[model samples]
Target: MHEVKKDGILFHRFDHLGHCDRLCHGVFTRQGGVSAPPFDSLNVADGLGDAPAHVRENRQRILRATGGTDLMWMRQVHGTRVHIAEKGAATGTPVADALITAIPGLLLVVQVADCQPVLLYDPRRHIAAGVHSGWKGSVANILGRTVAGMISEFGCRPADILAGIGPSLGPCCAEFRHYQTELPEAFRSYKGPRSHFDFWAISVDQLCRAGLQKDNIEVQKVCTRCHDDRYFSYRAEKITGRFAAVIGLSPPQPT
Candidate 1:
C-alpha cells in the first residue's frame, strides 16, 4: 500500500486499485484529527468512549478527504454478517462486519484497531466492499463470505476482484495464548513461535480459496502494534481509537 495525502489527511491506497479512475479508496491512518489523547486525532468509531462530536468531525474529515458523497459503515461485530449498499440507499448503521456496494459516491467505511480492514474492488463490475476482520472474523472466513456476496449480488467475478488487507496485527505481535481452545485445529498450522499467528497469510489464503487470483490480493503487512505511532493498536493500548478504511466509486465525471 502507498500513502496518499489529501487536505492534511493521510491514508494508504492499494497499488492494484490505486490507478483506477472509476473508484476511490483509502486505508486511513490515525493522524490529522481533532480528538484528544488516547483517542488523539482521527478517531472515527462511536460508542467507544470518544466524544460524539469528535467522531462526527473526524468522519466528516474522512468524507471530504476521500471525495465521497455519503458513507456506509456498520457496527462491526466480528461476525460473518455482510450488508449490501445500493444507490439511494438510506444510510443506516447496521450490525455487520462487511459492507459492499456498486453505487458511485457511496463510500463504504470500516473501522479498525489491531484488525484487518479488507477492501475489495472489481473494476469489471464497478463494485466495492469494505470489511472489518479481526482474528475472530478470520476464523469465520468473513473474506470468503464477502466475496461470495459480491458474486451473487453484483455479478462480480472473483478473478477480477482486487483485494487489499490493510495494516493490522501482524504475526510479529499477533500472539494467541489461548489458541488451544480459541482457535480451530486447522489454524494451528499457521501459528508462529510463541503462539503468534500470521493472519496476513491466512487472509491471503482465504482470498485465493475464495477464487481470487493470488496476484489480485495485496497485504499491507503493517503491524499496528509495531507501528502504533501511525496507527491505533488495541493490544498495545486497551482503550485506543479506531482508524478508518474507506472505498467508493468516484462520482460521475463531468461530461
Candidate 2:
C-alpha cells in the first residue's frame, strides 16, 4: 500500500490499484479533520455518536482529497446483504454490509472502527464494491458474496478485480475468548498466539475462493487495534469514531 498525503490529510492506497487512472480509491487514516476528542478529526461515520456537522466536514475532506464527486455507503449491519448502488436505482442508505456499484463519480464506502474494510474493483467492467467484513461477516464470507454479486449483477470477472484489505484488528489483538461458540469451527486454524485470530488471512482466503488471483489482492498489515494512534479502534476505545475505506470509478477522461 502507498501512503499519500494531500495538503495536511493522509491516506493509503493499494499498489495494485495505484496506477489506475480511472479509479479513485483510498483507505483513510484518522487525521486532518475538524472534530473534537474521541472523534477528533477524520471520523467519517455520523451515526456513531459524532456530531453530524463534524462528520460532514470530515467526509468533505475525503472527497476533496480524492476528487471524487459523491460518496455513498450503507448502514452496515454486519450482514451479508450486498446492495447495488447503480445510478438512479435507489435512494437513502441501505441496510447492508456491502455496496456494489458501476456508477462513475460515485464512491462506495465502508466505514469501520475495528472491523475489516475491503475495497474491490473490476477494471475490466468498471465496477467497484466496498465491504464491511467484521468477525461475524467474515465467518459468513461477506467478502466472497460481494465478489459473487459483482459477477452476477455487473458481469465482472473475479480475476479482473483488484482487492485491498484495509486496517483492522490484527491477529495480535483479535482475542476471542469464547471462539468455541462465537467463531465457527473453520476459524480455529487462523488463530494466532493465545486466542487471537488472523482475519487478514481469512479475507485473503475468501478472495481466493471467489476466484480472484492472489496477486490482485493487497493486504495492509497495519492493525487498527495495534496502531490506534493512526487509526480508530473500538477495542482500544469503547467510544470511538469510524473511518472510511472508499472506492469509485472516476469520470471518463477526455480522449
Candidate 3:
C-alpha cells in the first residue's frame, strides 16, 4: 500500500490497483481531521457517538482528499446482504453492511474498527464493491456474496476482478473467548487452539473460493490493532475511532 498525503488527509493505495488513474481507492488512516479524543482525527462513523458536526467535517476532509463528496456509506449490519448502489439509490437508505455498484465516481465506503473492510473491483465490467467482513459477516460468507452479486447483476467475471483486503484485526490480536459458539464448525478449519483468528487468510480463501485469482488479491500487511499509532483498533482501545476503506471509479482522462 502506498500512502499519499493531500491537504493533511492520508490515503493509502494498493500497489495492485496502480496509480490514481481510472480506478481510485484508498484506505484512510487516523492522521488527519477534527474529532477530538477517542474519535480523534479522521473518524467517519457519524452514528458511533462522534458529534454529528465533527463527523461531517471529518467526512468533508476525506471527500476533499479523494475528490468524492457524494460518497455512499453503508450502515454496516455485519450481514451477508450486498446492496447495489446506483447513482441516486444510495442517497438515503437503511444502513447495509456491504455495497456494490458500477456507478462511476460514486465512492463506496465501509467503516471498520476491528472488522476487515474488503474492496473488490471488476475492471472488465467497470464495477466495484465494498464489504464489511467481521467474524459474523465472514461466517455468513459476505465476501463471497459480494463477488456473486457482481457476477449476477453486472456480468462481472471473478477472474478479472482485483481485490484488496484492508487493515484489520489479525490472528495476533483476534482472540475469542470461552463459551462462545458464535463461529461454526467450518471456522475450525481456520482457527487453532490459541483461539486467535487469521481474518485476512479467511478473506483470501473466500475470494479464491469465489473464483478470484490468487495473484489478483492484495492484502495489506498492516494490522490495525498492532499499529495503533497509524490506525484505530477496537480491541486495542475499547473506545476507539473508525477508519474508512473508500473505492470509486476514476474520472475519464482528457482525450
Query: TM-score of every model?
Result: 0.98, 0.97, 0.94
Report the candidate with higher lDDT, 1 versus 3. 1
lDDT (Cα) of model 3: 0.83
1-255 per-residue lDDT for model 1 (tens digits): 788899998888999999888998888889999999899889999888999999999999999999888888799999999999865664788899999998888899999999999999999999999999999999999999999999999999999999999999999999999999898899988998899999999999999999999999999989999999899999999999999999989987779
lDDT of 3 by residue, 143-240 (tens): 99999999999999999999999989988887877415877777777785588877788899999999999999999978888988788889888787
Weakest 10 consecutive residues, lDDT, candidate 2? 84-93
Q: How does residue 22 of candidate 1 score in lDDT?
A: 90
The Cα RMSD in angstroms, rounded to one decimal, for candidate 1 relative to the true structure is 1.0
Query: Whose lDDT is greatest here?
Result: 1
- Candidate 2, residue 1: Cα displacement in angstroms equals 0.8
For candidate 2, give the lDDT of residue 239. 92
TM-score of 1: 0.98
Clashing pairs for predicted structure model 3, backbone only: 75-95, 75-96
User: Which regions in candidate 2 have their CA more than 4 angstroms from the true location?
Assistant: 253-255
